[model samples]
Target: MITTTMSASERFELSSYRIPGSDSCFYIPEFITEGEEAYLIRKVAPGFRPALGPSIYERLQIRDSPVQRWKQLANRRLQLWGGELTSNNVLVAQPMPSFVETYPDIINRLQQTGVFHGSPHGKPNHIIMSLVPSTDPSQTRADDSPGTKFVPCLLCVVDIFLTVEVCVCVRVRSMSQAKTVPPRSSSTPSMSNRQLQPHEDGPAYHPAVATISLNSHCVFHYYRYTLPESHGGRSIDPTPVLSLLLEPRSVVISTDSLYSNRLHSYVPPFQARLGMPDQRARRIHEIKEDRFTAGGAADFVSPIANWERVTDAATREVLANGGALTRGTRYSLTCRDVGKVAQLKSFVKR
Candidate 1:
């Protein structure tokens, strides 16, 4: 998005990356170096997160091993730092690992962006590491489970022989935005890799959110919650509000209303056949993530709010050519600040 010369941390012209209709959002590309991304990936991975200090682990009685902190969800794998929130939306404070709490790779870099200037903690106290499962057809099962099982969402990929019917872009708008769900686990597609159900972040945290994408690229969307309606007996279609390409090592900073007021979801990374074509072509199998059945396609158009600000040439070309791009393994560090923290030690017994 915005590129400006400034300090030793980052070079960002934040205003240049704002989303048009949004109150405040900055889509900054190359926010971290490739080496930094790799290091973050290793640190954030659940089984590989840097181990807790021996003294602290011993005091807590947790094994000093690489504690399996990762929790696999219905659609994505997650590793939460700063402990999990309770049913009442209380975040039991647990000191974050060195990589996040004290290390300068992410939090330090984010501070330079100045997006968290007025946050409760003056910085993000909670971080959720998310990774969508790969969508390769080889993982498809006869039962049509996650990787390759088709669930109708905003887009569908149906192909017949050498031809395909896929809708790359669609017109989606936000009708309303107001809801307060518990900060509980969410169920989504990680493998046919199904798309996540459209939803908003919990409102318990500060209204600002900074998402850092790493390793691979992804298409993240912002939309209001509205169920499809059958109009004039026509097929039901989803309505999306805004779309953006999240390039690797890039960070999307959304503040005020966008992060706190609307729903967001990421498309599944894998492709699946929506139907079995003529029996003669049963042997043909080449996965195209965006190919869908046009017989039931939605109105398509590339309306990414920050398309012009996109700095990646390849992503620009893909958007330029019908606005369809393949999904890849994406690891996102979703950082936020939760003002209310209950000490976990209070609940632990001696």
Candidate 2:
């Protein structure tokens, strides 16, 4: 049986499980119950069908398209709700799906935590659903799209099976002003115009990111951004500043410096060198490769930045094991409050 002794207010406090050596970040294990996680997985998963397609080849092809609504990416698929943002990072005024708006337990706790207190909208008005299939470590790619600039998002993961290593760029400013094109239809929108570029100043949204992990455990890595001397004479630190273990039903909150200063991405599956000398040597070898340098290292053995904060013994054991983890089908629902919103009527006339 699940049980907790802390008060609701205390549970959301930043001091409870904040990570060290970082401007602002926190972790909470078992933030949601098993029942809620199961419900969310059911909603995200494709439903079973009794009949097969006309022919064997057709059936195989049909199976490839797990969900019709997903916008296919090279490594993953995505679905957006409440319409895509405009060129100026503006969102059209529309109601989010009931499932998103009314995700009771999490929404209530987030509201209490004041994660979105200063945003233009009091709560999250946008949601991005990412469907990542099991991918080989060598085949996995980085998501450097402009959509990542939408900061202060709440990421909820369901059905995760492997450790996801994320690399983030902090303290670097983006100069690009790529436009955000809205989908053709709001409700059943297509991914035709989903490209996003970095913002000149920063994201038009707030600066807090909250993540909830469900059904799996993963390691979160944080890195500081640096520029090549040839570009502007500025140098970036290649080593990860912090790493945290995210267990099933856990929540992680990052804001301020952690949000604005760093770019975070999941680490691909690769075996780590157990000792520091061997690990550093391996990293140096990998860094020589253009792809590894451009993206970041996929494996490392440095101590997790927030290791002591994790209370789950199982997660600690996994981290202690220190090796390549098996991959699994994962679904992430990222919620954000778009600062700019226009009336639907005005959008239609345009």
In angstroms, the error of model 1 at 40 is: 1.7
Q: Give the clash total for candidate 1.
A: 22
After the best TM-score superposition of candidate 1, give how far the Cα of residue 183 lies from its true spot, in angstroms: 36
Tens-place lDDT per residue, model 1, 1-350, is 44432333665656766777676778877777676676666555323221221111111111221343446676666767767788887788876667654444577677777788887788888888776644444322222332212222235343323444442211221123312223323353224246665566786788888998876777666766445445633221243456667778888888877776677766642221211111111223332423232211122342566666667777666555543555545678899888778887877853
The models' CA-based lDDT, in order, is 0.57, 0.50
CA lDDT for candidate 2: 0.50
RMSD of 1: 16.4
After superposition, the stretches of candidate 1 with alpha carbons farther than 4 Å from their true spots are 1-13, 45-68, 101-104, 138-192, 226-237, 269-302
Worst 10 residues of 2 by lDDT: 53-62
